[model samples]
Target: MNLDFLLCAIRELKRNKRRTLALFAGYAIAVSLLLVITAVTVFSKVHQTAVIGTTGTHFVTWLPSCGDLSSLTEEELAKLALGIIPEKCKQNCENCTGCNKKPKDILNEGFVINTNTTRLLTIDLANEINKLPGVRNASPFLMFRFRDPTDNKLFTVGGLFLGHLAVETNSCGTNEIIEGQYLSENSFNKVLVDDGYALNNGLKVGSKVIIAEEEFEVIGIAATGADPVKAEFYMLFSEAERVINRRIHNPLENEANIILVESVNGTVHGQVMEDVMKLMKNDSILTSGCYYPASKAIGLNEKLLWVFIVVILVSSILMTVKLQLSFVAERQRDVAILKAIGWSNSSVIKQMLSESFIISAIGCGTGVLISGLLLCVVPVEHLLGIEMSIGSPFNALSMVAVVMFSVFSGVFSGLIPVLFVLKKHPLEVLRRC
Candidate 1:
């Protein structure tokens, strides 16, 4: 621990340039590998978590047997269907006497309906979920596989509408409009496409594309690090409904999917999930599920990433131990001579530890710098299979962990040699030399 003793030890190490360099190189390589692996693991987890969080709560889809519909009248059936009915229509229904009367009231009252039977449930929900209390926002969508009428090419597209709750940018967050305005509820003709989809189709803003017998003008583009498929196309909710030709009879009673819910005061998430499940239990016409951002797909990715990082750290430790042992063995004569001259074992240990610390620091610093530069220059989509965004707390923590690991490795390496030297006689070491 003495500065003078440590300096002297360092000087001795410097005198043997080859040995010193070998130890330095070994430490550096180990620390660098460990740091990179840690950073990558942390980054992946943070990125995935952000994607899931910003997208919405995950939910289980329960498709009740189609037979479930046979028992109910159209009015009862509409209540179980997932869709939206305009508020105006709901209030004006006092005059409706039958199924035909209900549709007439809805149309006359200028009500917009969402039918879960169509594929664009997500898109439709996004447009109207904001109107309800305890709702922050929603991403309504429909899942379907469709073919281009012109090319007869089949592709899966998620139909969605631009809503107030679009995903944010550069945060592994929600899918936001990056190039143009999001789909507007007032305008059902405009559409937004994902960046990847647009690239593949040779389309851009203002391009006209036809789907489901309707031509839509691409007005915007969006991106999702988590879902590359989102880039395919986004259209107005109404347009999506028309393409599929499904209608909703009741608004508040039916929903294809519900994502955002206001956090109730003093209510735990488990309680909320249970409540949601209970609410959907009797609605045999629909299915329901819930997702916690921390435990969903993003969380799984994070867990896997840490496993990868641990493997890297273990490998680094093994390599560092091997090299440090070799270095110490080569210096046995020097160590014995120092002990014979009244140098305490503690002093020798301190000097060795200092040398290891310096080497580890240098290695770790260089590795981190290189990693940061690489992250900056490399497009995240290509390197990590997810888009890279800055300012993730998870990523920052990983960097700190890397530095700590490097320091620990150096200290541990130094201890290995000290333990061996402590048990041996200086005379024996000298005689052997």
Candidate 2:
């Protein structure tokens, strides 16, 4: 009996091929749209994390060497007594050689001055910060500006610890190397110069460059454009210490002026900053991250995309339901004739549902194939400005979800109109027809 009903349903659909095709097209469009939106939503989330990583996700905690009032020299102190504000000197001393001379210039001019007690925090403090909750990793970095004796111009150098420099948030890792190679087993006395700096100085791989009165070989050229910890030259942390000791009257040990910190996943910039500030209460700590307007904009766009997906899903379902209602109305006379032939209401309902299931299954199957092909052929980056591809697992899951949802919608739509038509007697339906 079930087999007979199924055969009759197939014949009915075959008789009205145009009507069946129209209904299939509607279901196909809805399923395909859902699949596309889901793919984009997933990609947008992944892109957000990538964008944050490349930008200023990592916060830097640094003690500005000359910013402290006590760090000023006796001469500068005397000038402060004479009403020359020490704060102005600290902020604007880089260009002014007179009363506004900064501590950087003071150090470069008077190399013999001993200030061992100032300008640094121990690496142990960084280790402690690394152990804090929400902190991903912390690495101490040495930064200083040296006035070249040859040109009398100041240039900065950054000292990076080898193992710590390869963290996820660090942009100047091995991947930034465009020429030669990164520091390796025997990289002592070898440095990496920024591409722009190399171009300006006519330096290349194997070129000899003088830093802090010591000659070093350039092993790699890095294209670290506008990086947070940018410098003219980058060398091993130990080598930077050597240069610092050579340039100053007093030698220091295990100290770095800056500590670059990365936060764990899902941690916000404000939360990380608060944690670091609480840990280093008494120290003059300044924390900075890449939390700009653009980051906020990206977050807003994600919310909007989700809202759009919900709206599309609800509207598509409602439209398919309405189409099913109209289709059942046009076939009431046929339903009445089946009842007159002594067909049971339950059997009639099953046949109608069977037809709905077949249409939805074929439509959703075609939609899934179309979506897969579109994703593969389309350049996703052009639409979303992010490069991504659907993995096998996600693709398989997406098809299953679409098919399941289609089946539910098909059954529900068929059930509603079948019950509505079945409520009336067969004689009444026949008389009305």
Candidate 3:
């Protein structure tokens, strides 16, 4: 505690420059590893957060099934599978029970709403759902069914209905636009051709495509992975509603295929969904992960970082312990001299503790400096292929803990050897010296 004791601790370290530098190097390595691991974890989570922020959940009730479709030919039914019902099916099936069935009863192909869940495919219900306490975002999946008037009605499918809400939400939904621009929400008559559909049909961005006998310019061509998108084309909500109303005299503007709701958090998601489900008397279904984007790339990286941190902590402590043991073992005779000169046992312990504290402080400082050098100079993108930000996630409290832990490791490690050596009598220590 006294200045003389502090000076003694400094003198001890100053005498062994090589050992001190070696310990500093080891501590530097440990701290640098810790910093890099932390940076990697922070980067992974941030990257995922960025992606998720741009992404959103997609919720929808099951689409109605094509019932009693024996009226339409297999070719027409095949087209219906892609979100459209043939005009013949639409006209001839005016009294079709399937059309009149509730959205909960409709399960066209894979578009299904479970009987236990409620339907949320209208503007009123969607707005109500959005107003829920836990709901973060609520968007409707607008779908339309209308046959292209220009194409042959007999052989070709009757309708071309689709729900391309991804573009509407501005999230990379089922399709990602590769070549041309995506359909704007407010824009009308702007259609985006599916990559696979366009390639198979020889359609380009500028090509004029026919929908319900109306010509719409192919403003963009979107690339899609799901089979449903690749088979059919998509348009914005306004355009689709306009085309449907103009061609079929149906006021389908307020109708949606399903409502997609996202809650504020994971736990709240279920509650919000439950509240929505309660709104409808019909049967429906609920699903997860679609509401949020998870780090599909490095899902396990965070866990691995924790493991690395623990291993580094243990190894660093052991390394410090070993260095302190050697440093104290070499200075046993000095302890005997201090004790023989009437230095109290407690005083000797305090002085040795000071040395331990100084070593740890210096070692940790060196490690922090080295870590900074590596962070500043080294290329993380080249090595790990993950870019790290200059700013760290560790706050003042966490940074302080890091430094405190380092000093504690050094002081605690040194205390053991010093205490053990001091237990021996001064006469016995002098004889050994």
Candidate 4:
């Protein structure tokens, strides 16, 4: 605990040069492995986020089940329609056929979708959700039934189109256009079909598909390993509005049946999602609403990285403990001599701990420095195949934890063995000598 004890520990360590070097090298190797693996893992996560569209973002869906379309009351239908037809007055009702009832005589029991212009059911709630303070951004996910021009059949349920920021792709990124070019950002009557859909339907770039009676040419085919279940079509934001506008002339064009709320910060995401659910719940138009769970594949490399770190640390601990116990038994005479002198047991223990601490600290520092240099000098991003937009190899928090664990291992390994040796009588310790 005092300067003399510390000096004595340093002198003892220098005397045991071989042991000191071995322990230092082992600890340094363990720390370096931890740092490099951790650095690569962090970069991989960032890259995975880019490759998978929506990444960790969750969504709350409001999918109106049209099976009970007939059950919706006049007021409910009116609200959902968003001014597609006259809310009242049978006199102006275009669907009023063969009924001789006057405008006042006809009862406003329920409303029906014309189903002619657009078969898609889009309920935009972007404006309401966007108002939430926690929400970074909110996009409407609209799905509609579009008739395939060749087959004259409606596309399956997942024919969704979302408002996306850009129409581009990288080698391992989302919105990957494989065969053809993406749709023009400002263009209408253009669609981007998924690879699976195009292949199944014998559709290709430049093939025209009919949605709500209008023909849209397939401009591109996009693929993403993240989204295994492909959509029938992906269209521009402008084109989606264009398609849905005919069926429902809503005041808010951004009204999406399914809302994709993005609040990436994990701490706020739960609260933000709660706020979003509260705001959109018990609505006049919604039949049902629920959170859309995200699906992402866990990378094998990431799993293996942690396993390796654990294995390395465990091995290091076992080796250190074994070596320290052997070394202490060999030095029993020194412990006997120290105890025979005026040195208290606590003072000897403190000196031993200090020696371990210094060794651990130096080794940890050397390893971390080497890891940083390796990360900077080696093209880690290229080798790992994930861009490291972040400058540091090891995250500050992770580095702190690694250092602490390493120091603790050294102290623990030395303490247990030294305590066992000190427990016996000085004469008994010297008996082996």
Going through the candidates in the order shown, the clash numbers are 19, 2, 21, 4
Report the C-alpha lDDT of model 4 over 114-143, residue by residue, as the tens digit: 121112223335656667776666655544
For candidate 2, write residues 1-433 as lDDT tens digits.
3777678878999999999899888777777777776676656665675665335557666544344456778886766534365765546434222232223335453211012212456788789888887677899877767779888876777778776632324535677899999977578999999899899889999999888779999999999864556777888888877886665444546767667787664335557667777766544444344555545755776677667656655655675577677777778888888888988998888888777777777887777777777776764454676565435313455446546766566657867867877888888997887
Worst 10 residues of 2 by lDDT: 109-118
Instruction: Tell me each candidate's TM-score.
Output: 0.54, 0.71, 0.70, 0.57
Which scores greater on lDDT, model 1 or model 3? 3
Residues 260-298, candidate 3, lDDT per residue (tens digit)?
565554434456656776774333534545443343323
**Predictions ranked by lDDT, top down?**
2, 3, 4, 1
Alpha carbon lDDT at 344, candidate 3: 87
Which pairs of residues collide in model 4? 123-256, 123-257, 124-255, 124-256
Candidate 2 residue runs with Cα over 4 Å from true position: 1-22, 37-49, 52-54, 64-119, 127-137, 145-156, 162-185, 193-213, 219-225, 230-232, 245-254, 263-267, 282-290, 341-347, 377-387, 390-403
lDDT of 2 at 270: 57
Q: What is the lDDT of candidate 2?
A: 0.67
Please report, as a residue range, the 10-residue window in candidate 3 with the lowest summed lDDT.
Answer: 153-162
Candidate 3 residue spans exceeding 4 A from truth? 15-19, 37-59, 62-120, 127-137, 149-175, 199-202, 227-231, 247-254, 261-303, 387-402
Per TM-score, what order, best first? 2, 3, 4, 1
Candidate 3, number of clashes: 21
Better of 3 and 4 by lDDT: 3
User: Residue 423 in model 4: shift from native, Å?
Assistant: 3.5
